[model samples]
Target: MYMSTILKIAVRNLTRYTRRTLLTATLISIGVIFVIVFGGLASSFKNSMINVITGSLLADIQIHKKGYVESIDNLPLNIFLSSEETAEATKIISGNPNVVASSPRIKFSAMLSNYAQTSGVRLVAIYPDKEIKTCPDLAQRIKGRKDLSSIVNPGEILVPELLFKGLSLKLGDEIVVVATNRDGAVNGVTLRVAGYSEGVMGPSGKDGYIHIEDATSLLRMEIPEISEIAIKLKEFKYLSSSYKKLADTINGDTFEVHTWEHLTPFSTIVKIVDVLILMVRVILTSIVLVSIMNIMMMSVYERIGEIGMIAALGTLPRQILSIFFLEGILLGLISTVVGAIVAVVILTILTITKLEFKFGSMNIALTPGIPWSEMLITVTIVMVISAIATLQPAIKASKLEPVDALGHV
Candidate 1:
């Protein structure tokens, strides 16, 4: 039989049971809509949170001395990058075309005193110009700072909001920061509070920023030392390629390079979100399998007499099988197309609504969309599953004996 003839027969048979076909297609369509919409929303949320993290502070990647991360909680000064190592890293970073900007930091734990009150704080000392370039949104997180061109200057500090509130410190107020050097020598420096920095993780964060010059003065170091380097990329999509290149060139026994995901606890939540999306796909697959198989089986059972008559009239078994298989394929194709259109419309509406929500101290807006690749994959899954689900029933219909099927009521 010609393919066209088989398709026409399939269409006629489906129309013969219009209600059943519509119900099955509706179920499959609902499943497709759910998967696409949920996947879009989840992906949008993940991307938004990542932007908040990388833009506000983490940057796209970070470089540090080996074993520094293991003892990061202590902010050990002994493991800082040596002058030579810092120079080499700087040279490599400057030569990389993918690196948009990089900032060297001197991180340490210190006691902050507002004359009457004292608190332990973790401080990151950086060059104002480089830090602003590396972390574009860093300036926005600082309060009452209109001259963002200079985020923090020499003899000045950006205190965490929690610290500022707890110590009753105001901008431009003098504060004393005391710390112990690598050789166990105690030192202190007086700095003016430049601004209050909002915490990325709500009120629990105690991180503050100061100029590198002040850090050198407080640590009493003869030469400038760097604890780590935060780097931004030209584009986030090139992160893997850039990381591999940097790792091959700079990562060694004394130094290490890591992406933002490796440095934060938020990576775990990203993984969990991915797993949940996979689970939703699995559920959609189950729905398609059960709905298509059940409908095809019922169709075969109801049309046994018609199948036997066709066989008696010299219709080949292969032709009979093709007819039933085509019906399943057509059902899947139509339902998937309908579902995709509906999903696109619904997602567009959501984007237009400009839904907003907060994660920690960051506000995020949802812009949900389904990429073409995702839509193609979803359609392929449905079509393939539809064909598989109809196989057993198609075979049963093709193997029926004419005399036995004719004897049935």
Candidate 2:
């Protein structure tokens, strides 16, 4: 009976001060909205960023020869290992279950020229089958639509559409590729342009691709000491574990096995930003709790005389506390529900619009959109703050002596 009476009193007081109650709730709602919007967008962006780098560009892991980085761009032509060692490494990588596929790559700076035009390009020599498995996007492009995917023979090359435009070259146009051979000889190979494309390296380059046989012939070497080895994993979540295992298995004192994160330093930086975002949410929630505490304190002051009357009529001090405490909890619960509804409606509209952004000179990855986990976390924080904020006022109201409270009136 006492509990019922306390709850009724809480409801009556909340109804009577609707304006003040609503104003406090509005502040909490704003904080909740911030969490939902940022959290969802952040998750989306992270996923896109990972896909671009690992899926098309870097692969999950890369193995490199010692001292290769120092002179990779302007390589002094020389073979580093026998074909046997290269074969051994490939076999080891293929046998690992964690490794989806591995590809051998040789990258060199070269000048590709037709009789009338010339352009600089990064010549990458890769096996057709392995390359396709490593970069499915490249295979999809070559298989149809563009007519560039029809070639199965060596000596055929693919040039990005950008390169084609800049060089004024067309399909089947013969071009000369000049680079240093493994024996320090300046070797040149004239080959037919097998295809034209635009995926060589983002926006502005005369970048082109070639088959492994062509690369071997042009460089005058069986294997031109791989500057990079690309590895795909079974899944992204196991990347760290995979990285450690690869390092242990392929433990060469002269080389380093690097995860995509090592190849692209910005991934670590983005994770740091994620941590900072969570901290900011924590600080904002603290501010909301302070506001709630102030509002509850004011409610207690206004009801002091009424509380004293109830106590004099044999109402326990604990019952007086329960009324104020229940009111705070109700306020929190309602605000959380309303905030969630607003967040969902707003997020749904924004997602349907498919918002996009293009940064200066670069195509920014599209935002990933909102997530439900973010909304739940935000609502949870708000409700917890509400409960915590009421504790002080509830205790004070419960401990006040009936005589002292009545004497003030």
Candidate 3:
């Protein structure tokens, strides 16, 4: 009994029950398509959200004082990097090949008064040149500001849209900002409104920007100090490796480095998306397992007489088992190929349509696609489950007695 003969018989047996075979194959194919499409959409959405966070505000990586982030909610001003520490961190960051730009910021909470109304706002004081380079999309988030060269200047402030609308502030309006310094002393400075900034997360965000010089003046600092350093990479794909290298080089008890995922609360949403994907995969596996096993069991029962004839005609038990096993493999292989082709076509259509949806205040377009490795893994799992599903039926057919099988009605 040659392997070719067994395969030919397997094909013949499948065609003999064309309707059943097609139904089983269709079920498995549907499972594959569902998993591929769902996984692709989920991945695209996750990546888009990440890009929004990283590009607009939180750059790919951030370096902060050891305790700065833990108490970030309060915008603590006392725990800051001194001028010497900032200089050292900047030097190390500049030397890293993966870092495209880094901006040192002084963040604090301040009360903004437009003379008629007052609001509490979180202010991030940045050097315009360095900040623009580190967060390229930061300028885009500012309403009516296209020129990145002058995002914010000395004695100027970029206020959040919520604050701008709430306080009825106009460009060039003089606003007084009162803040407490690290020395527990309070000071106030008047600054001109340079522009209105769009919130990164939603409309409720109260983050604003100002010039480092003005921040120092308002805080009454004798020397410049930094709260954090935001770093950008040449590409998002370099995130993991760049983070590892930077952490290895600069992280210590005094300073800590973190990726954008670690710095934002949106990371919890990303994790939930991942768990959903895994659940989809598990459902797909169950579909394949049950469908293949049911088909194989029915196939074995229907061909008992045929099995007895083959066994009595001197066919080897191993050969009979091989035929059933090959049928399962062929069914899995054909269905997987069809499902992959159809999935790719559907994904291509989605990409061409440029499906758009809203996330917060931003309109996001989905670019759904599956990696080759993921597709390969999917195919492998289906085929392996197919073989396992066919095993009991194949073994049972091989062990059937010629007398008992032939006597079946």
Question: Which candidate leads the pack in lDDT?
Answer: 1
lDDT of 2 by residue, 64-94 (tens): 7655655655643442434655666676678
- lDDT of all the models against the reference? 0.88, 0.71, 0.88
Instruction: Estimate, for each residue in 227-336, the C-alpha lDDT of model 3 and write its tens digit.
Output: 99999999988999988888898858879899998888899999999899888888878888888889988998989998999988988888889989999889988989
User: lDDT tens string, model 1, 190-283?
Assistant: 9999998887767778889999999999998778889999999999998999999998999589799999998899989889988998898888
Cα RMSD, each candidate: 1.7, 4.2, 1.9
Q: What lDDT does candidate 2 reach at residue 49?
A: 59
Candidate with better lDDT, 1 vs 2: 1
Ranking by TM-score, best first?
1, 3, 2
Number of the top-ranking candidate, with TM-score as the measure: 1
Model 1: ten consecutive residues of lowest lDDT: 369-378
Off by over 4 Å in 3: none
TM-score of structure candidate 3 = 0.95
Give candidate 1 regions above 4 Å deviation: none
